[model samples]
Target: MADGEPPKPPPRLEESVKQSQLSPQILYSDVVKAHSQPYSQQPFELNTIFDAESSALKEISTYQGKPSVVFPFSDKQVLVEKLKYVLVGKFSHGRPPMDTIKKFFVSLKLKGDCNSTIFDKKHIFIECVCKEDYYHIWLKLKWFIDGYAMRVFKWSPDFSPMKESSIAPVWIRVECLPLYLFDEMSLLSISNSIGRPISVDPRNINRTMLHSSRICVELDVDKPLLDAILISFKDEVSKNILEKFWVKVFYDEVPLFCSFCCHIGHGTGTCKRRLEDIRSGQGKAEILSADKVFDNMPQAENSTNSTKFVAGNCGSKMGKQIRPSMEWQPIGKHVPNARSDLDNKVAPE
Candidate 1:
């Protein structure tokens, strides 16, 4: 293709997407192989350097004529005494507390959630701004707000199974939209991803004009991973709107490895429970079987636990099956066994 020319369909758009050339794709092995520095047993020059660096940071952040440090000393408030002089002393020595700096952040309502007493003491408000990086900053800021809400506003924790609590969003996008854009199949997958609070709104359009159709996701999770996942998901959604429209997702931070181990990561086979299916002589490993009954089971909804055995409804369906035994005895039908009639072993001895 000439300069300014977009490349033609390379026969397999899905494969092309899997090989996206843009960002660094650090694999699990890569992270595991990185070198880590050992902790020192004794105080070294590095401690001095860190102290000096902290001092410099405080120097740049001074707030008032009193030489109030931008960063407070490790401790600013006292267990029992007027603390202003101690803070002043630390600021004089350029050793404002890192803990106090965090307090300052909360006071400014810069952290997640908004109702913490510190925020009350500091006072702040929430606002939305549209800009180049609005989406990214918005996700981060939401988490901070949500955190504040939980701690100070008395909102429930994000992951806890509680109503009235604030929550992180779960970002979801299927890259195979070109193949199954608005089908029930993809919608169910999206629902599985939204987790507890958020809901899914599917795209309604016929196949002929699906290219012009668009899919929108509103979730409560973190941003960066959501954005990264969306990039990969572009290959999944086959809508025409995606041809020129940039795909984006932003939600709260969800740990990639933990989610992966919980069977929320890529491809179903690597899931531990999925592996158990193979060990138990279930059907072979499958990506999308025509009759993936387990996948369709209502019990499978939004479950992070994959270790549980998937016991199917054998012939009698859900009711318990009675085991046949030659020694079977109906309730109060038979006399006690000879062993029960006999005295204890010590009594016999």
Candidate 2:
């Protein structure tokens, strides 16, 4: 009690508590390390190509691993240029007079430069820069070529794709048509068998051409589908009927694309499959048969005018024609003909 000494300072509570609680602990996990080699020098490849051909077993194996698909929109713009268009018929004995061909293409504005046209021995190939230009050249040269007929086919790796004779409705001349077949009902049935009947010559029901056996029918069908139907019809008739009524598919000098393949720049005559058939003696020798062209029409939306027209409700005016009765008539019976003198502003004497 009598000792002189300095008093000791009290211990800090926070430091003492922290020191007591502190302890070393270990954590464990699988770690992935970067490879020693650079990415370009890596030994492994991401994609693998299998040599095995497709079969039921192969399909079953890959079924679970299939990637999610994105369906293309129907109206999606085709990114690739439709560069090729074909010119059929003999342009010249040798290399087609390139000068004349170039002038023709330049005149049509299809090809601005001489380099765009490539001449083959049997056909001339014109390179169109865009789809629109390709289509324009196709339509322009289809029917009215003076010396050489033009046929535009779809581009394909192995062969030309099947297409219509023309974008417009095809006209088929039915020769040796019996008097009985000239009736509206019969004609309509025939047209329906082929495609949507656009019109029969002398569309007026009263003024139907009874005297002439030949009937010219305009069908709202691409040439290929119509040709297939015609061939089938002709074959069926050939077996039963004695009178060989020739059904002339009027391509009118325009060449047709091969029905076997859906290409635009070549005809069935030049098709590899067709040539092979020819070599094997399986090719058709008769000129009466139309070259089978269409396997199927392009899938179209209801938005197009052609489809709307085929649906028979093209315009707002057709609404009035819808009657409560079963019968349907597009043209009125009592309407005066615009071509007649009575309706003309200046009556012809």
Candidate 3:
């Protein structure tokens, strides 16, 4: 109020708020004091409390719980059995229209009616009405439709759309196998060295053809397939001498093989592992050259007119000469002397 005296400073916001409520320390002390003043109470019966809880749980379980519906085991088995006759097909490079695939099958003039359905927009689920058609479609393993390779797989109970089939039935021609080994047992044993033998060509069973034996084998696509096998047999001229014969194997309609990962369904160019290595600044993974992997196998010549020599005289002498250019033709091309029994069964009508 005096002229020389400064006006009293306004109360601070914090001081104003503090004046309205008790301090935190006082509040905490009061809470502790309250909790420390324990009062006596009558003891409760444990059995009564447990009984009440049990009654509540029973009511909730009986009234609020939902009943689970389980699928019948017999029905599941029947469904799986029906699925056994189904085959799934996927194009290796691209997915063609469903109508185009259906038309292609019709052109083949399949033995029985096959109901084709699109599976996951990427595969074709083929349900064959008759068992004959099912085997016919599945046995071929790969079909060329419009120059695209259509890989067929048998539908199993554990079939998944996200995963690719790593096992396929591949028809392999075992060349350079001596005429003596054309018998069923010998052919089976040789094919077993490559994969699990499924069936031998009908011609091989009758010994009608001696040049090469064809056998269908279930090959694991994840493993590196053998291009040739070495068979050690006692020399016919000398009982004490053992000779090694390298039998060359040729696979028909095998899917893309990856040398980087040594797996099928993908090639080294598209290998995920190689891409990861490159992305991480590690450069490309060391890919094993085909020559290094199959050291003893016969290598194809670079010349257009190169000829493959047959095994003879302990793999020293060439018994027959095969034109390498014509031997491994691209898919969908008809060879001059291709077998008509199975390979060319699905001719366009």
- Where model 2 places Cα greater than 4 Å from the true spot, the runs are 1-79, 82-95, 109-115, 130-132, 143-349
The C-alpha RMSD of each candidate to the native structure, in angstroms, is: 30.2, 23.3, 22.7
Give each model's clash number: 41, 14, 0
TM-score per candidate: 0.19, 0.27, 0.45
Look at candidate 2 and tell me the lDDT of residue 327. 21
Clashing pairs in 3: none
lDDT of 1: 0.30
User: lDDT for model 2, on a 0 to 1 scale?
Assistant: 0.38
lDDT of 1 by residue, 154-259 (tens): 1221322222122233344333233343555454444333332233333433444332223333332111122211111224556422221111222323422112
| Candidate 1 vs 2: which has more lDDT | 2
Tell me the RMSD of model 1 versus the true structure: 30.2
Task: Name the runs in model 3 displaced over 4 angstroms.
Answer: 1-82, 91-100, 129-132, 135-150, 175-181, 184-193, 226-254, 258-265, 269-277, 280-349
In order, candidate lDDTs are 0.30, 0.38, 0.64
lDDT of 3 at 288: 37
lDDT of 3 by residue, 209-273 (tens): 77788998767554544455545455676764244334566777666656555445666667798
| Candidate 3 global CA lDDT score | 0.64
